[model samples]
Target: MNFTTQRIEDIVVFTLNETKLDANNSGLVKAEFTLLMKLESVKKLIIDLTDVESCDSTGLSALLVANRLVHANDGDVCLVTSSEKVLSLIRITQLNKVLSVFDTLTDALQELKSK
Candidate 1:
């Protein structure tokens, strides 16, 4: 998994630098989320999936894992993506109701900041 992380105050921004988030790499992403949630003690998280053009069920599972982890600690997680396919999948799965979705990193950060 190619990624980078940034911290703004208490929020951690995880930028996944991959064109496809599928079964091939979703496990690593899930592991990283667990590590970030447990070891780093991250409460608020922003998953920047701008580079991810495609996603599979495994990818969505990884996101749910992140959401579960953060919310378990009384925190929140948001996803930022400009891919229409990704957005459609979220809507089709009704994950839009469960996860916060944003069109840009700035938008996600602003919302998370307010919370």
Candidate 2:
């Protein structure tokens, strides 16, 4: 799992640097999300998947795990991706209704900050 994490105020921006987010690395991503959600100050998270061109069911499941953990902590989690495949999957799975999706990190940050 190639990724980078940065804190912008109270929000944690986690950028997945991999081209594919699949079963091979989704579990690591999920674990990272779980750990981040446990922190007292991390109330908002922006998962930047701009570099991720492809995603599998496990990848989507990892995202769901992040959403669940964040909401359980009374926090928010959003995803940023420019990949059409990823966007299509979110729509097909109806995850667009459950998770906030954005085209850019700036857009995601603004929305999360407003909340």
Highest-lDDT candidate: 1
Give Cα-based local distance difference scores for all models.
0.94, 0.92
Q: For candidate 1, give the lDDT of residue 31.
A: 96
lDDT of 2: 0.92
- Tens-digit per-residue lDDT, 6-67, candidate 2: 99988999999999999999999999988777655567989999999999999999999988
Alpha-carbon shift of residue 64 in model 2 (angstroms): 0.5
In model 1, the runs with Cα more than 4 Å from the true position are none
If scored against the real structure, what TM-score would every candidate get? Answer: 0.98, 0.95
Instruction: Measure candidate 2: CA RMSD.
Output: 1.0
Task: Locate the minimum summed-lDDT window of 10 residues in model 1.
Answer: 34-43
